[model samples]
Target: MSIDANKELVRRLVEAINRDDAAAFEALVAPEFLLRDAVVPTPRGPAGFREAAAVFHAAFPDFEETAEDVIAEGDKVVLRWTARGTHRGEFLGVAPTGRVIGFSGMAVFRVADGKFVESWQCHDRQGMLRQLERAAACEGGGGR
Candidate 1:
């Protein structure tokens, strides 16, 4: 795929995430795909992305993802993004605190055969944890 096509694939991925559409992931991501640096270990391929999306959506149902930057070269595309939402469910063992929160992250994807073959992502887990802790403390629960 051309560089523009590769970048478009990444954009579609962001759209799928915003919609929380697992089927879209399944169609766009290769069966042998791998995602790294996520909150949890994802199984290979689109199933892993589906699982990862479910976890975050379960915790923040109203979350919206935005691609702040997208750049592509050859078969690689980089996307910087932010997700903002109100926490209404458990997250990594943290109970729901109805807290409004946001997290920023970046991901790099490698495309082959017009499908995402692999990707590495990095996000602000520590910042999110601290926010969750603050929410707990404010909601009459002592933070760990």
Candidate 2:
């Protein structure tokens, strides 16, 4: 696929995540898709993506990610994005504190055959955790 098309594929991925669209995830991801990210436990295939998305949605029901920039070259696409959400469910052992949080991240994807073959994601996980911690403290609770 062309570089622009590959970039679009990633953009659609962000859209799918915002919509929590599982079918789109299946369509955009290759059967052998691989993920490199610390926030998720199991990091392989479309099911992994779905699980990660579910975790985020469970913790932050209003989660939304916005792509700030997208760049592509030689079968690789990089996306810089910002995500915001309200904590409503437990996450990473942290109990829900009903606090809104935002963080920025970037993901680099290797695309082939019009689908994502592999991706490496880096985001402000610490910031997310810290915000949740503060909210927990304010509410007289703690991470579980």
Candidate 3:
């Protein structure tokens, strides 16, 4: 696909994420989509991707994702994004703290046949953990 098309695909991905639509997300991904990220567990594929989305949506029902920057070169696209939402459910073993939080992330996707096939991502997990901890501390739960 062309560079603009690749960038458009990434933009749609951000929309799907903000909407928390798994079917919409799956439509843009290849059948054998692979996710490579340190925070995510192994055996990652489209289903795993959907599961991760579910987890996030469960924690932050009103989660909104915005693409701050998008760059495309050949079949690869790099996306920098930020998400904000209120924590109302569990996230990565952290209990709900009812705190509004924001985090940034960057991901590079490889597209083929007009669909995302592979991705490598890095997100601010430590920063999110710190916010959660601080919220807990404020609630007398004792944070590190």
List TM-scores for all candidates, in order. Answer: 0.94, 0.94, 0.92
Off by over 4 Å in 1: 141-144
The residue pairs in collision within model 2 are none
Q: Write the per-residue lDDT of candidate 3 for residues 1-144, one digit (tens) a residue.
A: 899999999999888878777787678888788888777664555676777677788999998889999999998999999989898998878888899999999999999998899999999999988887787677775745
Off by over 4 Å in 3: 42-44, 141-144
Better of 1 and 2 by lDDT: 2
Candidate 3 displacement at residue 72 in angstroms: 0.5
**What is the full ranking by lDDT, best candidate first?**
2, 1, 3
Model 2 Cα lDDT, one tens digit per residue, 1-144? 898899899899999999999999999998888888887866678888888888888889999999999999999999999999999999899988888999899999999999998989899989988898998998885434
Judged by TM-score relative to the true structure, which candidate is superior, 1 or 3? 1
The stretch of ten residues in a row with the least summed lDDT in candidate 1 is: 135-144
Candidate 1 per-residue lDDT over residues 18-59, each given as its tens digit: 798988998899999998965777899898888888888899
Colliding pairs, model 3: none
lDDT of each: 0.90, 0.90, 0.86
After aligning candidate 2 to the native by TM-score, how far in Å is the CA of 69 from where it should be?
0.8
* Residue 13 in model 2: lDDT: 98
lDDT of 3 at 82: 94
